[model samples]
Target chain A: MKAFTVEQGIVAPMDRANIDTDMIIPKQFLKSIKRTGFGPNLFDELRYLDVGQPGMDNSKRPLNESFVLNQPRYQGASVLLARENFGCGSSREHAPWALDDYGFRAVIAPSFADIFYNNCFKNGLLPIVLDDAIVDQLFSEVAATEGYQLTVDLSEQVVVTPGEERFAFEVDAFRKHCLLNGLDDIGLTLQEADKIKNYEQQRKAVTPWLFADV
Target chain B: MGKTLYDKLWDAHVVDTRDDGTSLLYIDRQLLHEVTSPQAFEGLRIAGRKPWRIAANLATPDHNVPTSAAERTQGINGIADPVSKIQVQTLDDNCNEFGVMQFAMGDQRQGIVHVVGPEQGATLPGMTVVCGDSHTATHGAFAALAHGIGTSEVEHVLATQCLLQRKMKNMLVQVNGKVGPGITGKDIVLHVIGVIGTAGGNGCAIEFAGEAIRDLSMEGRMSVCNMAIEAGARVGLVAVDEKTIDYLKDRPFAPKAEQWQQAVDYWRTLVSDADAQFDKVVEINASDIEPQVSWGTSPEMVVPVSGKVPALAQAKSDVQRKDWQRAYEYMGLAPEQSIESIQLDRVFIGSCTNSRIEDIRAAAAVAKGRKVASSVKQAMVVPGSGLVKAQAEAEGLHEVLLEAGFEWREPGCSMCLAMNADRLGAGEHCASTSNRNFEGRQGFGGRTHLVSPAMAAAAAIAGHFVDVRTMVEEA
Candidate 1:
């Protein structure tokens, strides 16, 4: 996990609604046990003209030049601008892992599916929800300007555009704290390990069958 | 105020709650599968952590397991794809090392985690269930507080047996009248998703209530709750009833004798109070539900089996118009085209969403005497689990399907996610019983029309969509 206070990076516009996890990282890539190396195949179907299989060298694959990330203008982009209902299908954590591995630090969208949103925080990728109108403006700005950059300050919960315009966002406080410090949730939960142990003991007495081996 | 079922389930599972409204909810059961659990297990090994309660977890490989008997003959070694084999092997190795009970590939009990859970009585009323897969909501059919979690949360639940969470708002999707003769839970849920759109249930726990829901069998109820994720709700629930108790009665893991009576007594109280409040309520008439078929990528891009592909002019906004246009391009269909006229190349009648015995029976009933159309390249039936396959075979359902030109295959997730060898080819169209019709969900560049088991079977016979109700009347 990586700590995040702020990041200033180029923005890539994904001008579509309901961009599902399948489009983010297709099911084929999910076969890997290890999480890394997903960067090369992020949005494999949309990024390449041909089918993507694991272990295929991605560089030599024909590029879908029309894809937002494949275009030269969006090269090396770290901020993703998306429409409503982004990351809408599947609870594959691979979606977030692929986004993070693909050099994206944050995603700005009007809305996101719940599991995908939760998964993003877990993987140290920031999913910022803003007003639909604001997202529209961001999308427009990124399209009109080449190499558009935005400064995302997690500490202040504001996204600052290149022109110094700032837009505020809301996030859960505890989640914010975890993001700031790059904390492992297991360690945090373990601090209250005694509480968990006691609860299990009490639960065992009430639902004995649940504790019994099958 | 009277508590809703969601409130009662949430309250019962609370180990602690902070001022921020984040509750440390104790998970009573955790279901694991190959695709998502490996990373969590890897994380555990890296951290030198052990699972909080060894007995609380149940694991199996489904997502990447080959479903063909010939390919699966060697068991894990028979899996052809090396990458997929490793994932299944990793689950086997981790479960062996961690001492978690697992139903290996060849085991009759092994199947999709959601199906295996209820069948084995690993899921029970009042339990707080979490799985790395989204369809874990299927367990909520037993009146459990169940939802999907990501790999990180999987690891967290593995280590602490608790999840850091916030309460979701309560929603009631009440279906008032009786469902039509041919309507199944698959039809009702798809109709609900069409009405709600994909994001309608976001941030809320939807309780499928009213007369119609109460009327469904335990399997039908499971089918409804299973697709709650497609409706944009992570948790979908049904109140406990006689069906729930009856389904759990003789299961291997269910409580026995006096304890069973006690459990049933407690479960009877698991329903929402008569005056319980809901933040949102959606009233639907069951008669309004028609056999459904998804025409486009998303599950919500659906219509009645007799309906037509939506015209771009019908889109409500620029975003919707663009989405509709993209769907048309990807699906290679014109606006206002009748759904029944859409030909299919293949048919798949299996998925966690509809692979239980009831679903298989419904499909078999349709395929009993009808021959699959010549235009249909292939039609396959992959039962949900080994038990389901055996039971179907005992009933001679497999013979009926085979005689009708449908391949009777072994059990696993199969083409539902296309991680295994079974998948759709580019430019091919399929009538699938699986949940999602998202682009490439079945295979890259494959177009999928989501339908019920009977509907899928009917499509295979006709080589196109047809009203299953009409077929029943003709028979």
Candidate 2:
């Protein structure tokens, strides 16, 4: 987990609505346990012309030039700008894992599927929810300007555009603390271990069958 | 004020609650499958943490299992795809190392995690169940506080035996009136989703009640609750009743005779109080539900099988019109086209939604004396589980489906997500019994039409979407 104060990077526009998790990483690429390698296969079905399998050399595969991420202008983009209902379908955390692995630090959408939004916070990925109009403005700005960049400051809860315009965003205070300190969910939950152990002890007495493992 | 079902279930599972609105909810059962658990277990290994209670976890491979008798018998060793083979092998290894009880390959207990959980009586009323898969909502039909968790939360639950969750608001989807004989729970649910749209149930825990829902079987109840996620609801449930208790009586993991009486006594109190307040409420008439067929990529793009597609001009808003236009382009169909005129390249009659014995019997009843049409390129039946397949074969359901030109394969979630070998070709159209109709769900460039098992079987013979009501069993 990397503590985040601010990130200044290029933005890539994904001009599609209702982009599902299947479109983000697809089902075939969900097999690997090692999360780092998924970067090359993010949106494999939509990114590559040829079919992708595990262990296949991605450099050998032909890239789909028509894909927005594959276009030369959006190279090394760290901010993903998109439309509404992004990351719908399957509760696979692999979707966020793929996005984070793909070097995306923040995803700005009007709305997002509930599970995907929660998964992002726990995986060191920031999913910023902005108004549809603001998202539209960001998309057009990124598309119209080459090498467009935005400065996202988590502590101040604002996004700074190239023209020094500031747009404020709301984030849960607890989540903000975790992100600022680079604390993963497990690391945060383990702080209250005694309480968890006591609860388990009491639960064993009431629901004996649950613990009997019969 | 009286308590709602959501309040009751949430209160019972609270291990602790923080000032910041997080509750450490105790999880009674954790269901695992190949696709999601491997990475969670890997996270545990890297963190040097051991699972809190191995006995409470149940694991099996379903997402990538081969659905063929030859492959099923040979087990994981016979899996050909390198990625799929590793996913299955990792689950086997993790289960072994963690000492978690798992129904291994060739075991009759092995099946889709959701289907196997209830059948084995591992899911009891008023319990808390969580799984890495979204369809885990299916367990909520038993009056449990069930919902899907991500892989990170999966690791957290594995290590702590609890989850930090915020309570969701309560909603009631009450259906009144009597359903016709041909209307199954699947029809009722699809109709409800059409009325509500995909995001209508978001961030809410819904309770399906009223006279019509109470009359459904335990299996039917599961089917109705199974697709709550499709409506974007994380949790959906029905109150426990005689039907629920009767279904749990003799199962292997259910309580013994004296304990059964005690269990039923507790379950009887799991319903919402008469004066309980719900944050949101939706009402429907059961008799109004028709056999449904989806014409587009999303589950909400549905209409009665007898109805034609709506014209783009009929769309209520510009956004809706744009979505419909995209669907029409992807599906290669025109507005106002009769659904029956659409041709099909394949028919898939199995998924977690409709792969149970009753669902299989319903399809068999339709395909008893019919042969698939020549225009249909392929038709297949993959049972939900090894136990389901065995029971279907014993009742001669397989013979009926096979004689009707359907290929009867082994049990697993084959083609539901096209993660394995069984998938649709480019631009291919299929009538599927699966819950989702997301674009590229079955395969890349494949078009899926959501249907009931009987409707899927009938479509295989007719080579298009035809009302199953007209193709009733011959007297």
Candidate 3:
């Protein structure tokens, strides 16, 4: 996993709310458990009108002109702005994989479901929670401008807009430390290896049956 | 000080408190399934470790197992899908290597891990159960502190007989009084979600209490607790009662004679005290609740069947209004349509959430001697487990379902969330007893309306949503 700090990227705004994991990547694309190759199918049902077929010529298809994703200006966007209660259903880890594969390094939303938010961190996608007012400002600014860009400084905990508009966001101290260091939940657990080993040894002595069959 | 059932269960499981304010908790039972176990077993192998408590762990294959016999062997073989096949093979190998008990494909005990664990008596009161599947909270019906964990956490629990975690604040949700004649446990849960919204119980462990809960059968209690995640609870529990004890007696894992008396004595203490304090308390009167059906994508978008579909402007918050608008556009539902009058193209009566024998019988009772509507293309009834299937067949529920044009299939998670081949075609609307009604939850672009099994059956016969009580009265 690469651990480079994200600095600046063009913004891609998804205006819809309650965009579920199923829509992020439909169940048909989930045939392979391997986490790769899902990025192309991300929003498969929405991006294509015909099932199992990509947008015909990427031009003749009935383009959902209103969809921020279908807009030409947001191509190669790395930052995603979304509404509240995003990623609302099923604990499919593929949702994050699709986002990451689609080249989105960070997601800024008013709020997110617990499971999907946690899964995003594991997959190296930074999900920044902001107040609703800040989210509304970002959405308006991006919608008004032709090509909007935001620079996220992880080391400084700041988001800088195109005209040097700087906004600060708060992250849990521990989670920030983990994100900066690119450590996951397993990595955090492994940090206490000596303590875990000692506990195991002590536990084995008390409950011999636990280790007897092993 | 009085203690709620949540506190009692938490206190019993805590081994020690670490310096960082997290607790070292001992797990009484660890359930495993094929989908999430392969990676964890690979992690264990890489670390050169063995399970600390082999006897406390049980494994089963459910997700990838095909519901039809023709596809079963073909599905299990190293097919084009190498990852799923590897997952199944890894479980088979790991259980044999570790000497842990397993319920493989074709095994009578093989089903959804949550369903199999309880049906086999592996889940008992006061036991802290951990499973890799999120629906593990279904086991909380036995008064156990059951919750799901991620793959890495699964490895940690296997390596050590304990888990590192923080305690949750307690919430008591009391639904008192008797349910109206037609309301089922599924309706009660959907109603609760409707009232509380989807994110109502975040970061809380909910203890479902009061006379209404105590009166439900064990199967009904499981149905209610299974969807607790839909309301954002980490866990949902009911107090141990005589019904709980009766369900656990003489099963494979239940303690024998002498130990049984001691276990029962211990289990009796799992209930809450009369004056138990909770951080939050929400009460609902069961008599006022009606049979519920989801009109939108999220579980919280449900309303009583007697009510009209909610307009976006009627939503309480801006976010809620946006959600309502999005659901309206996606579902093609008008704001003023009565929930009772919406037409349905299909009805599904199976899932980990509501596929037990009781659920099947409930649907069958409504479908008996009544043909499904000509406009309804497909109506399916898939049982949760082989045991449930056999029992329902022995009771002639299968014949009734078939006679009524419902496709009775083998036990598995069929059309619940579309993990299997059974699915709703695009743009189709269905009355489902499954936990979720999210966009394409049953199939891509398929609109789902959540309802009880009897309601699903009734809707199938009527070609639209209908009250089951009216059909019951006519019958």
> Best candidate per lDDT, number?
1
- Candidate with the larger lDDT of 1 and 2: 1
**Which model, 2 or 3, shows the larger DockQ?**
2
Which candidate leads the pack in TM-score?
1
Error of 2 at B354 (Å): 1.3
Ranking of models by lDDT: 1, 2, 3
Off by over 4 Å in 2: B473-475
Colliding residue pairs in candidate 2: none
Q: What is the interface RMSD of each candidate, in Å?
A: 1.0, 1.7, 4.0
* Chain B TM-score for all candidates, comma-separated: 0.99, 0.98, 0.97
Residue-wise C-alpha lDDT for candidate 3, range B215-302, written one tens digit per residue: 8899889988888878777688999999999999987777676667877887888898998889988999999888999999899889
Runs in model 3 lying further than 4 Å from the true structure = A1-7, A52-66, A154-158, A162-170, A184-214, B14-25, B45-55, B73-100, B159-164
Q: Could you estimate the TM-score for every candidate?
A: 0.99, 0.97, 0.90
Worst 10 residues of 3 chain B by lDDT: B75-84
Q: Tell me, what's the RMSD of every candidate?
A: 0.9, 1.7, 3.6
C-alpha lDDT score of every prediction, in listed order: 0.92, 0.87, 0.79
Error of 1 at B245 (Å): 0.7
As a TM-score, model 1 comes out at 0.99
Residue lDDT tens for model 3, A70-101: 77999889999998767766666667878999
lDDT of 1 by residue, A1-214 (tens): 8998899999999889999999999999999888788998898998899999999988899999999888999999999989888898789999999999999999999999999999999989999999999998898898889989999999999999988999999999989999999998889889998888788789778766667665
